[model samples]
Target: MTRIRLAPDDGKAINLNWRDRFVATDILRDAYVRYEESLNPSAPPFVTLDDGLELGIVHSDVPAIARAISSMLTCSLEDAKNENGGHLPSAVVERVQLEIISPWGVANLWGQTGHRFVLSRSGGGGRSEILATILVGQSRQTIFFLTGRYNNLRHSTVEEEVDFDQPAGDDPDQRWFDLFAFPEIERFKPWGYHHIANFVVAKGHRGERLSRRLLEGIIERYAKDHLDANERPIEHGQHLLCGRGFWQIGDPPWLTRMERLGFYLRWGAESFFIEKPWAPLPAVFDGDRKIGNLEYNRSFGLPERYQGPRPTVASDEHLLERLPEVIALSEDPNAKLQYFQTMFDFC
Candidate 1:
């Protein structure tokens, strides 16, 4: 029961209202971050995958990441104001940013890839800052790609001079992480990921084996979460970590480059949740098919019935998609935990 403490308190808990991106003022966002931090911040679950791979969750930086993602991947403020009906013109851009970085939207994208949240990397890590849910087994091919890896493992002291960490104020750098740079982190990075939408190394820390260390961190996270009471590693069948552009099937150059990191599957399927990180809304998947939010329920571990059914994320719907999922977790922690740890560990 030894938890991974982020600060004094932090956990792998995901934000239930992750879809609500309309964080208006600094006051509101500050309050929300405080509230989330208060949720027993502890060490996130982590696990070791192999010699140079580790996995762990980002616990306290959820809100920080949310804000940063909005800013980093958003449109101009004036354009956002026009998107919404001139309401809150000053805050219109912020509103649009919120919708753009909806937590559920990001999660959906994670699921679309083989690294779906519910399906992969279960059993631990601060589920809050999940990158991907990787199943463990002996025969599984854990395919991690090296498309984004640096060219060499040479030594360099250049990155040490610049500090990527941010002060306690509203500094944008504070919201970013230095996974490869290894800077003096007075503050942590923007956030963690599950399906790893953006696991980038700051330009300054591009090479010198920093990316390798980052990979080890990811593997360590998985090992921590998937271990048994006996401290034995769980081996899921065919586990594979992938690099970017991996989706570009049949690329000989991509294949040759990725082979250095790990396995290279020529025919593994890849998915793209187009709605994610764009159209913000919770999804209702009935078995393999996606139903409206209304059809989801506790029986299937989703909740469209509790509230009314909603349409698309872009529609005029104020649906709270995290509520049902949160309730289910509370209702059956043991079962869910057990299920996550083993049910699909081999799939």
Candidate 2:
């Protein structure tokens, strides 16, 4: 068995409970086993299989989980589950509690620490769970999750002397949290430009059909609560918004799961781009001139190796075209603002 820590407390201090449950190599090993079995529909609901043993599949997610199971079992999860009956239980969704300790902490630690957790029930006598967190700010939304540890589960930090007293507004971008925002930049703004659209989901949870649900849920929730029936933006203090783009690590070897989640390659920086289903982009800034067009105070850039469509190139155009419509349709103004601002900061 191996040991690894999942969530850390303040980088310096660690939560022993979370560390033991999520990071301990041994516990992770068990969790991994349950994860593998969950992907294999042929495997009984709660039945565990010995390594290399022939097992039938039962029910599982379409492609992503199938791929993961196939890779793990050296057999297709579809084939295994098909051999059984192709029926699996619905994933148990548990909304984990998350608390932002400090105001600046939410911006500074955003993705690094602000996300919450959720778990799924594995087979009998075992637990299969997924931990996910979303960081919304600057009109940018990033969700990070730890599935079974193999696909997406890595956190790195080093102690450094610095100031924690700087007002959060002073550095709304939290330049210090580059790693947290790197994935989005990598996928959406590879050429060093500001990209308002971006998102990423780790491969592990892709198989569970969780990504699409999560993404749609985010968008739908934003639409319903954030936007009004007229699609006008509502006024809220600082808040967060959620969208889709390349928000994960480099191109994942497995994308079938990603594709099923309503993501498609939009060229350049991101391999997966979430289609903005609603008409017009949401109005982000509070004070502005003109009925159409959102304003930005800074110049945006494109990321390196970016020769494709750049966000900065089309940002202004997109703003003009989407602003009025977004304002009319959106119900949550603060979230819309946060999303746009985050994009600026992320870029």
- Highest TM-score model number: 2
- Candidate 1 residue-wise lDDT at 43: 29
Model 2: C-alpha RMSD to truth?
20.0
Write model 1 residue lDDT over 1-347, tens digit each, in one string.
Answer: 12222231221222333222232333222222111222223422333444333343322134443332223234223322423322123343354344323332232222223331111122123222222222111111222221122111111221443343533236554322222211122211111111222332322233545445554443432333333323534333223232211111222122333334443322112111122222333333333454432232233322223345442222111123433443443243221111100001100
* Model 1 CA lDDT for position 112: 25
Worst 10 residues of 2 by lDDT: 88-97
